[model samples]
Target: MPSGGARASIDLSSATIAVTVHRQGATVPILIDGRIVMPTGVAIGPTGQLYVGLDHAAARALPADHRYVDNPTDLLGTPTHTHDAAPPDPVELLAAVLRQTTFYAAHQIGQPITELTLTIPPHWGPRRRGHLDDAAHRAGLPAPTLVTAPAALTAYATTLGLTVPPNSCVLVCQVDRHPATLTVLQLVGDHYRELATQQITTPHDLDHLIAHRVIDAATPDDDPLRTTINHPPDAPADDRHALLESVRAARHLLVEHDRAPVLLPAPRQPAVITRDDVTTATQPFLDTAAHTVKEVLDAADVDTAHLAGVIVRPAPGIPALTERLAHATGTTPGVVDHPHALADGALALTAAHQPGPRAAAARLPRVRLRITDLAGILALGACSLILLLQPVLTADITTVDSYVVGARTSVPQIGSSGAFAMLTALVIAHLAPTTWLAGTPTGSPAEPTTGSLIRRGYLAAAVSGLITATLYGLATGTALELDYRPYLTWTLGAALPLAACTALIAVTAPRIPADALPTWLALARPAIHYALLAAAGMFLMRAALSLTIPVDLTGMPGLVGSLGAALLGAATILTITDSRVLRALAVPGVAIAYALVFTYSTKSALIVAYLAALTWWAVRLTTKTLHLAFPNAGAALHRLVNRPHS
Candidate 1:
């Protein structure tokens, strides 16, 4: 490349947008004439006329009927008077600027503009890039290559021979007229990746800081200056615009010299703003910028000792900002030639990668997954574990708590809230078998027809049972004073009766076809298994608590022993039987005969009979839900058939 060879780049920022064309191989990167415009002020009227470079004041002053379309790419859903009266889009606005700049550069250099590159923020995702690409296409430019701001800055830095050592981390502090962004970039081998980034909103803060200082420097007689500086929202649009532009100019001038003269409305002397005044006014903003740099580094998990240096946009040369950045990052910051360093690096990137999907994807540093998902998963797991285990662990602890309940003595009657909750869970579990059966695959030879619903129901029931057990434990801890903590014996004792009843019913009960049931009941079969589990679990917990009518089993030990023995013998016979109706009647027959012959008291006999009847009824319902409706019922039946004498 020759010293005078053409190179062009565009920088689009929220506050300002500029196109710079410079020589490729020049020593200082000689800047030819360029076009600069306020991007925020770019608006299109209802008349389809293109308006560019209007200040914020003029934009807000459009007639009540007129709509302000600041960003062209966002006007997709905006309504127009008619198809013919459709307004210009963002692409047109962008194209017009590019066309104007290209024409200007071509006339000055006596050659047609060929290559153009664009520099954008690293955080701007795919959608924004697509918008820019469409705009460039409509602007009639060979899709200009796109580059990130940090990449462009690094490119310009390399050109200036201010490159950081390989593997070193650098923080880029981008403070423009819009919001400030602090990006941490690590140079790995020869490539750079963005480690972390943070955004800070300080646009108005800086402007207000400067404006306040300039106004304060005036004489006490300056009431007009005070009022203009205050800049009420209801003020004329043009006046507010002038005040904003005035403060901005003073800010820029303060960067170069000690003092800048600011001209305001009449009847007030021009305010002289010193660099010290600007520093004092903007101390908070500078503090925030410095803090943001440190935050970005912290977010990336990089130590300050590992930092290479902080790189800031060049023009606003404030030593206070440099000192604060050094203190925050433990490294003195370096400067680019100007904010245009972005355009320079963009030009470098354009030469390296051509415009295409592959090039664009490869050029972008791969984004890391968000940490929030992992945090959420951890929180959910912790809550579930606590819910499951809290009751079991705290059973003994409740004994101590019962003593501390301050003697609100009442009748020892059981409340129904825990029972009701368990019942609800039971109903839902009961419906699981039906749902699984309905959804089972029937047409395929590869599919097994009988066991799908049963397996699903069992699974659903087991889940619901565990859930109900957790709820029962929690509720019992709050409602009753019983400790079942050494839980293994109680668990086995509770399971024995349920198991025996299930075995007997499976051997004796008549098999019912799932489709023969009512439509509503059939649909609910899948959830019924879950309800059964919850009910069984709650019943077990009640048994473990020894909660019953205050009858003393110890007073009639002989009767209790006989009752227990009779139940065991009956369960064994029914479990081993071949006849279905006989198996079903066996337990009831044993209970009735035992109650008539062995009982000394009618209440004890009635209690025995009631327990037997309830168990048998539950067993019958469970077999229907499982054997007929459950997908895995055949396995249980097969196990029963193959069982030996034991």
Candidate 2:
């Protein structure tokens, strides 16, 4: 993780991690072996995805506690991939960098990175910095930090004599698609100070038009949306050949259309655009950058009446972009330099301003952050915490039979993957412990009447019975006559099995101190809860989706059998090594149950098998739930269910 303590012996030559980069759109890795042999372009990883060469970094930066996030669930609660439409994630950059760890094996000869030098954009604020730090920590690249892109460039340049004439200014411009940054430095005797820097994203109707045109070229099967280069037409081209060629293309386009087309160079591409072409396709962007440079100089209130020459940089070789810059500044030298010039200037400034190696380090004071109310954020966090725990606390008994059916779906005929089965059971296990929490809420003091207790018991039983019956009737339809006796027999059969599980919860719950209930429930039960939540999620989702005439809750009977087998396997595994396997076993069983039922049964049979499975799962689910709830009687009842016949 990113270092947060005292300095350690860190060697730059050996303390390097391979970083893969997927910027703007290029998804690939560019390895940097601490020693800076690379000069063209350095790789920049997003946030913090880092790995040791050919090895996994031992992550040690997560907060003391962490909770499960509901993975992207399908419309019916089945977990789905978080790929498409995942918010514009910086994490991808981190991932790319971490992937580079593999290439290290191909060509190694080094020690693990102990210190990291991360490069982030200057525009990013403290919050962004904090998040980046966290990411770096997770990747095991934490230490004496380096947090600025320009700063890193300056450091590199300083090693190469990094000096310029006094009273001269070196302006740097990074011409890329989104925003173009323009920074100017003032050389005061021995140091180069940043006079002004501004980043501006072009805002013109031309890009919109071009964007529309680009999309129009795509087929219906394509991933239609695409982001073009961030700059307008005038950004300097890196090569004469590229610039001339693009100008030729633009000229050809000009001949074809009465209105000029917007010109933008793709990020990282070596294409060079001409000044006229840039002005035509993307004038506003260039104008903004140019205007900012002029304004910064104006703000300095410099005696421009007799200032030294201005060295304008249009991203190194892009003369088209720089030609205009020089023209605007009217500097005698008026030549474009490399983009790193500003960073080099900054390094010189820092070094000249503070001569010694440990200069100004102690002068910095402890800074406190000032903010407004945190109530909204705190409330949101609390609400999320509550909803996450809701399933464990309340035992509605509405679909306890379905829950058990989820258990029984483990039947082997369906060929459930062991992993899938455990997943389901774990899900249930999470909710089960919670179902029996709080000493089962004892009857009120004065109102403790046997009759009322009897009513409550009957009410629980009746509610469970009705929900099971109604769901069954709906799932099975009226045709297949269910021998109510056998149905009840199967449900009752679950009582013993469920009671056994409840017994364990009853035994464990009381042992945990009051404060630990939420802790255990939240932390230890993630796998268990998520799995069950996912399974129940699948069941309801499948059923809900089947809203029309005879919608299949799950596929077929064989699947129900498979689900039952999976559950059985999970029970065996858990018995041998009682891990969080409930949800693990059940979700797959439920999923497999649906698939099997779909494959084996006729449309009519699907309803019967699904409802039957639901009934079974519900019974087991509820019985176990209640067993965990009331310790004295619940525990006794649970033991009775699991115990051998007298």
Candidate 3:
């Protein structure tokens, strides 16, 4: 067995154990005092007798009805027992084995094993997984992290220093007492994706073949051994069971020795079985297994040249099977000889990788609220309140320019600002990060890619801007006391410019050059930072020009003429250079030209632009402050608010 120091120091109450349940038996491997130890899965007989490790000799002695062998193929099907009573539930039988194994491991470590990782067959679906989970719960074990056998084998290969590059394929073959299972898996980023799986069955059972050969060599054709073999049911149950057990023992012995002796029933001498005999028996199974590996590779469209490694499990080494696989794949296969290596691999993978994106989303709501989310809520709430109470809050300051003659403030009717506030709030609430966009936690199988995040950010900004313009148009039209037809025209006119600007920014932001940005702006993502900066500068300049420019020069006729010229100028400048610095520099000139051509009264345009800038600054500052004050809590809250409910 491979030896090494413990990978992690787990607490007694929260210790995790990894278990693999196969046709032969279940194995649970645990770390104790820096060494890995395996405890056998124990099953309870119907007669209340305890069978530990399902010893071949002891199992043979039990009545046929009471013999327990795990049948993973039919997890929900109960094995037949005596007709006197119903057999133990398949789930219950599995539970008994898991419970015994868990207690044994806990006893060795002097602590409770509160967590579990289980290796499951690749083809099993939700029903089978749920059944296994029910068994674990019945055994008083924690809900296990179920990993496919192929994934576990791939993980074990990595621990062995077998480097399979990303996007490459690895083949794993699991051979036990039953048919060998062949699986092809591809390494995608940090996780393994199963490509194909097949089960290879031999024409004859290896144990029966070995037994028949031994009997022929040791006894004459007319011997009682030949008669017993010819009709198993006619022989005494004890003799039949003894002969089978002896054959199994000899097969195991030959795995290490070139030759071994198999004891026959009474009045018969022990027969010597050579390694060649065992090989002849296993050769058919190995050939089938090798063919299945090639077929699985073809099915997965993976070439032998792209196959980075081949891994086989249940390691006391299957030399013939290994050789066949190596010859077929043109790559020497790595043998995991340690009996409990599958369980160990499961445990190691659980420790090394974080949950996937879906799992992280499910757990997001339970996460504690952070300071950043609280800040966002407060900032948004404060904006809504101010907008709703705008008429009352600014009732005293009715004049924007006291020095300029006839410059009276134009306050909207009571419900106009309130309606805009309600609509804006509704739009923003719905635009919060969706489930797919929220992504996984750090170090998870997959994280939100940079491109996806940028797209989401731009989408939010565009949607928000469009909605804000619509709300503004409705309120402004109501305050202006315009007729329905003119109001409709005015609303459309107001919305179109904002929409055009949003599209313009979206198109330009990505094309901006990195070196063209100032050193201060280099800290943030180029697209997001530039978009935000351009938006902020636009509003700030609009407010500055509205307050400073004389009203006559910004009359309706002059405004329309200059506004069209300014747009043409800005578009030309954007086409000429892809520098964000130049783009930002052009904003002030555009705003100045717009103010000269457009009649934006000091009381209306100035206040709206100033409020927009104030809200953006407040949100930005609050987010930064909260992140610095309570770093962890702020991050958690950000994820919660942004994470999609679905």
Candidate 4:
């Protein structure tokens, strides 16, 4: 009922379906629904819940037990006669989409659209149309006009006031998601009639082929984006969506421009897709498109010499297609100008035909959200709020730092406000938007082996933590009081956790394959998480002791030294995974550790022991060696420090 172009149109494709409404007085058509869902994907989740459309749960690689039916059109396959078998439940899926469309029309136009003029592909015969009509009826729409896509485009052209010579032939080439189709329409006394339709199936699905090419060309084999594409994460879906959009945009730009830069995430360079790239990648598709034009003309028994005009569908990446089509048709091609040309034509036909009364309003099905989706939303909100408060938090921390350092300061023990800011900062770091992307790898077998490996990693982290605690305890003596804590505790506490995480990786390296180690390391780095834990521990310790160090110049060296030591440990574990590098680094590391032991007391012994353990783990793991005593050693240290009499 929104009526600028006289008829509303639906452009349904394999990728997504959209409805366009022409507002009164507006020259151009407006798209009402923008949700691009998979037309073929209809699935039932683990809970026996039907989840149709482009949903993550359905799109993701399903387990063996899960039920997913691709290309649900078969479910709606047309019956031969009245007593034919009933169509499958996937009819509900198509009906569900129609009800949604009806709801959209009601909301936008303030009335239900019972009489719709459907524009379909020329190849969709009576059977497909029959199924479509059935779906519309089920969705509460009455019998509507079904117009072929080419005829609709011809109608749209006629509405646009483009004159067609009587007894002449016009070829309309439509390039969409699936394949290229060329339909010959014969003009007779101002009316366009479909004469022949030909579908070119070779070099199929150009968009999909081009996207894969761009991805392969732009990204390195080791890049996480490739892994993400193959095994999609439980996402930041926007990134995944943006990646595909960039590829499509690149393809479009390549049609007109010499080269276009497509932005991909870090570690993956932006793809500079060229016109040559498009032509080369989609050559087969262009050839197919061109070949289809000849097929349609031949089928219509029309000669290329007598063809009145050729209309190419206006698509960004189809200039080459147009060129191929023109060469085949032996006529200069006119671009369709409007993407909704077919829709516009259908709208005009419906206006002229004047179908039955509008159908009554119908209720649409509800889409359910999973628990993980809710948690992700909440996490995203929390992260957003934290990010907004960062500047204020930073200012507070600076003020506290100045108060603690200045000669005229009177802030008692670096107040909770300052500590709170530090804690918040730790939280913010952990909650970074990229954290989800960098969190975990998908498609790892959900078996006991993986579970055991995770347990080992945690145990290793705990052991490394205990070793650090015991080293500090030994250095400062059995009393280990908070009063003796150095000014470097803040840095030491923060750095300790990262070191433990590094140690955790080194300890688990042998259990995991060499090829899989890097990605696992990237996701399980736990540097930020450990930093938060360390900050918490330091906060508790400082609060218990009512202690705060006056900011002094001398403390800087100790803080830097603590950070350097932690970094040294981490770098050693991560980079020296190679036994040759491990051996080369270990000698100097041990020399330094020994010197610290003699010069800096028994506390230096802990640092040496920690370094030695890390070096041993790296060396042994690289050489396919195993150490059963490592976890036990950590347990001994934990008990020795905490249970003094045991």
TM-score winner: 3
Candidate 1 global lDDT: 0.51
Give per-residue CA lDDT, model 2, range 513-625, as digits (tens).
22223333343332232223323333332332232222244675344444533443333333222335765665455545544444323332433333234334434444443
Q: Candidate 3 lDDT, tens digit per residue, 1-646?
A: 0011112111110012233321101233454323443223234566666554454455555675565543422445334455755554667656665665666566654445655666777777787778778888998877777778778777877888999998999998876544567889999966889999887777555565567777777788888777676677787756766786687777677678887788898776788878777667667777787788789999999899999999986422245778888999999988875645667666667654632121112111112345554454454444434433333222222333543122222232222233233323323322232223244446343644322333344455556645654555455445433323433343334333434433333333332221111211222211222222322333233323333332334455444434533443343344334568987897568556544644434324433343343334323433443332233576578879999987
lDDT of 4 by residue, 402-515 (tens): 343212111111221222222233232222212233334343344123324443444454444444433432333222222324312422343344444444534444344222
The clash count for each model shown is 39, 79, 7, 3
**Clash pairs (backbone) in predicted model 3:** 315-336, 315-337, 370-637, 435-644, 558-597, 559-597, 559-598
Give the Cα RMSD of candidate 1.
Answer: 29.2
User: Which of the two, 1 or 3, has more TM-score?
Assistant: 3
Q: Which stretches of candidate 4 lie over 4 Å from their true place?
A: 1-8, 13-16, 20-88, 189-191, 211-246, 253-258, 261-268, 355-646
Q: Mind giving the per-residue lDDT tens digits that candidate 1 earns over 604-646?
A: 3333333343344446556554444343468678878999975
**TM-scores of all predicted structures:** 0.47, 0.31, 0.48, 0.45
Ranking by lDDT: 3, 1, 4, 2
In TM-score terms, candidate 2 sits at: 0.31
Q: lDDT score, residue 204, model 4?
A: 35
What ranking of all candidate models by TM-score puts the best one first? 3, 1, 4, 2
